[model samples]
Target: MANPEQRPIGDVSVPLNTGDVRGFKKEMGRLLEDPLGGAERLDQFLGLNIYTWVELPSILGILFTMEERDMIRHSGMRVWDRDSQGPDQGDQKWPMQDPGWNNQNERHRQNMSDLQWMIIRGIREAVPKGQNLGKAVSEHQGKDEALEDWLE
Candidate 1:
């Protein structure tokens, strides 16, 4: 009979981008100073850094994969347009024309909500039953080394 000790821990795979993620954890040490101030700092940090990572191409269904492919797939332009002029479809040069500002703002709000829901769903899916997703740094993690349940 096979020993339970040799069994695999989980079906979920470690995210490919975790190395990039672990780099951001350095700010955590500073968060211990004053939580409110830390939160503000974290907000700034995430504003500058986190979105680009979280909003990966795959996450947004941009490119299908990192593997080489010549053609690209897209559902046409996302911005609303009248005739040929798209909302926020102005060149960045000095002669900037009025982009459909109303439509742009509406799209922005819709996108914000979509992003929030997507993140929440991703979090829910990552953590299966009986798994603690997060805990305090001082929590009593045990010494089980095989599957590392003790680290929880």
Candidate 2:
């Protein structure tokens, strides 16, 4: 038999429901806004973090919310204006709308990959010995699949 550690976790897909999408988006946005606070961070709380298949939908959902909220302006990313791409139109920007992060390029998505063991090691180095470190690591392991899948 394969060792438990060698076994693959079941696949998790991002749900298509709007509310779920919205909730996930909000949660991720909250995380990105501050990668160092809240119960969520109680899990694997440090790293450049990559997205996994499971996390794709929610991340995209959050990106959509940011777009709608204008929290991320396309102009800042140097994307062409929507109207500018076509004939004379209103003040809309980025004709061919796309995902953005903290008003940055989709490249921010790459941050996920950088968030690996190095980050965990960094956290271990920063925190003291008796400050719920074990609990933090345990919780983060539980969420690893979810987080990793989202990055894909």
**Which one is best on lDDT?**
2
Q: Say which candidate scores most in TM-score.
A: 1
State the lDDT of candidate 1 residue by residue for 10-68, as single tens digits. 32223435443345445433222333343344344334222322343333233122221
lDDT of 2 by residue, 14-66 (tens): 33455654554455444223433422342333223344423433433443444
Those runs of model 2 whose alpha carbons end farther than 4 Å from true positions after fitting are 1-16, 24-33, 38-152
Model 1 TM-score on a 0 to 1 scale:
0.24
Residue 139's lDDT within candidate 1 is 64
Q: Residue pairs in steric clash, candidate 1?
A: none
TM-score of each model, paired residue for residue: 0.24, 0.21
RMSD of each: 23.7, 19.8
**Which ten-residue region of model 2 has the weakest summed lDDT?**
74-83
lDDT of 2 at 86: 40
Assess the local accuracy of residue 48 in candidate 2 as a C-alpha lDDT between 0 and 100. 31
How many backbone clashes can be found in candidate 1? Answer: 0
